[model samples]
Target: MTYPEIKRFHSNMLESITSHASQSPVYQDLETISDIARLSQLPLTTSTQIQNSFDRLGVEKVLLAPIARFWYTSGSTGKPKNVYYGKRDLDDIATGFFQLLYLCGARPWNNAWVVTAAGGETLFGLVVEKYGLDGTISPLAGEMDMIKALRHASRLHKIDIIVTTTWLYLLINKIAKEPKEFERLVETEVKKKVKIPVFSTIVTKYLLRGINYTRLGGSLQNAKIGFSHAEALSPYLAKIREAYPNLEMHDVFGAAEQWVQAIQVSPEKDWLSFFLRYSIPEIAPPEEVIKGKEDRNYRVKGVPWYEWKKGLKGELILTRPNECLPLVRYPTGDLIEVMDPAFSFEVNLERGKMKITLPAIKALGRAADSVDFAGADESGNFLGFKVYSRQVSDALMTIRNVRWWELYHVKGSPGKFVFLIIPENNVSDETAFKDELLRSLVNMFQEFTAAAQARAFLVGGTAAMEDQKNYLELMITRPTAYELIDTEIKQRIKEGRSVGQLKPKRIFVVDSDEALSTLTRKKMEA
Candidate 1:
């Protein structure tokens, strides 16, 4: 774990890495992996799910303690868990860095400043040292709080190279809303003197750095080659190139659990080459177009077709040339669209950080997101109504996949957005959740509907609603409610009509706090 074993890699990179994996007795017992991974068949993987698979397919003492550092995710909505990847996973993935660095024409002496999610021996930091990156690296300044750290590093220290996640860079832009903390942190890091580098991820997407350049001893900024992984790069970062024209921006296609997938030197237009990395990625989106024959649960179609003019982007899947993990064709939750005849897929700009265009435009080019439902504002913020209640539903997706969703009306002193988070599987989970939703529904709309006398029938018949829920409940009660929405959204999409956009209609807007009631009535009346 002292250094990241860096070496050049390319499309055939999988062969060499797996060749190394083949040397391991753990990987040698490949047949046992099926039971180890806990899958009848390899399906899509997110970091959280992979941890479970690792536990089932692996022993903690054998993998975690003996070989490497277990990398965990930020777990934005939940608790964090450590990732267990073997030495082969580390060794092979590093080839990607060597190859991409070679493409950018980098050197060994460059001072490295890693900006990945909390830089430590975590994944990226460990990889950098293994590769003999011969330079100082910066851990994420603290949960996407990188501005002060980067500014201080650039203006003061000696940074030569940079690597970090896309979210951290976006967060740098966000921290500005707090003026004092931003300035104070910058001033503090200045004393540390973390210089700019040739290996910084944030500024690497630059076009020129004549004036916006922070200098140390009057020298030009040093961090030249930048790698943005974890999430996709945004177009906002693209414009930064105007400030640091010499920087090299490479989009790294990999994750914590699985390590490296593919690498693209420039995502400015379309991803160019699929760096021969340790694993050959298979692109497949969830099955929405048709049903899965196995369980009939759901299935995603299409593979990463490198031949098409626009890259065939789907769920990112990987089958190592050596097959590091036990399963075959494990899908990564990331949605991608491949373009250019060469072997590259578009980073999903919709969900994570890599989106280049604005929200309005980002969804247009994509078929992966709520994009198929055109004309609907399937994605975007509805912050205005958020204060009224909790954001239980993804109201942003105008074109939803569920049978229907209700925006419950609440009249309370302390206002809340009573999102009757109905089960997408209400029909399957049966009357319990439906009844629960009904109770919430009654609680939300009872006063308003009763006073207005708009619809007594809707509230009075509780059993009727329960019956409806019973009939439509899904078979697989999704792990989480949000997951149900994600599953159903695609199902509704493939069968439904293809529209330019599908914007959600504001079915009900009840601002019932007495203070706003007068205004609400007026607005509703209008």
Candidate 2:
């Protein structure tokens, strides 16, 4: 579709949704907005509003009607928000997934292993059937270990494509790289008689044998392509490339509230191209939405995707009028960088040749994951700056002997950051490991110092710029063995209830020093 055609469709969708706004108590005030220009004038819908009126935001009697399915957010920061869909909404979402799969190099006859959570099964089923692909849905829930499932599926069938989250992909890569360590971990669990389904002696033997077989080219070798979503992929892209040298990787962007929105088409291209048919894309400046005044409401203005220029960074706003619970200018809480105003791609399908042109963007970490800190200048004036989860993750990924880590910032104390880490068992030199971590922290802080210095030079003189330095303090401590065991047991229990339950909470904020201390304690008395 041409740019003008896409704009017209967006305007038409806005008008259609407005006509139905009176039926929804949450959106009744939007009934008067008739066009895209007018729709931009209203405040962006916050997730809190949607959560507060979850059952009353859609069409009239939506709950009374037969709904297709209900989806939920990960609730990493707060309570999970719920959104219901009708049959039509499912159909639209399936269509979007179909296109996304095609862009990810999926063919009709190829066998695909789709590893996803509960809410996405029906949509993937539709895509598989409609596109004539042989697909299997491996629920992230239950007693089934996802890594074991992938190995068994690859052995049983010639799996060509694997779909899963970025975290899962990283975990798989880590296990693949160190099969012996994985075996030891599982052996420890077995010795302790952990009541997890995946820890059975029979399953453990099979999993170990499968890992060995894969080293000789048995599992995941047939799979030529992969699709990773549900988390930011940029921070770990280099690691993924090093691990899976032959596997073609594609990063997808979307949320539970809105199904698939954009996809990365090629490794040569650094941005994800939006699926214009599904929603109207918009960008809201970070200052107006997330990093603004202390008393400012979350609501902020947005610029339509077409008007966005290259290098613009902000929170992504989306308007999906076609959904059953139509979202009018919704704040998705995801940070993004607009890479190109117009990115074009041409593909040849069985039917004919097609060309797609749309705005391309890069998904940064979530806005909520960013923490702002301040330091007093030479004149006793406070200068503020922000740190992002991606920066910290990227720095940590460069360090050796690190298994998993979480960053916490105390709400009232912005200058101090706490890290709770679980290092690899091979890390025997604790002091050396800590020294390496501190080096990485210093390198990350240097980048911020340079940026702050430039800002200070612009605002004041060279003296103020020279005074700009790192003010952040790092508190790094390894989790005690008791705490590690407790966390692992809890995670396994949660996994029995849902897929993607093992995904880590990498970054968050605490209200008090007690909370931070509790999480970052190095030793616990039994």
TM-score of every candidate relative to the true structure: 0.48, 0.80
| Model 1 ranges off by over 4 Å | 1-58, 61-66, 74-81, 119-128, 141-158, 165-181, 184-223, 266-268, 288-311, 321-327, 343-526
How far out, in Å, is residue 192 in model 1?
Answer: 24
Whole-model Cα lDDT of every candidate shown, in order? 0.39, 0.66
**Which digits, one per residue and each the tens of the lDDT, describe model 1 over residues 103-208?**
5445666666664334243554555666676544454423223443545444434555566554344333334234445454444444344355433323433312
**Model 2 spans with C-alpha error above 4 angstroms:** 54-65, 77-80, 173-184, 187-217, 286-299, 345-355, 374-382, 398-400, 410-421, 428-447, 451-502, 508-516, 522-526
Clashing pairs in 2: 140-499
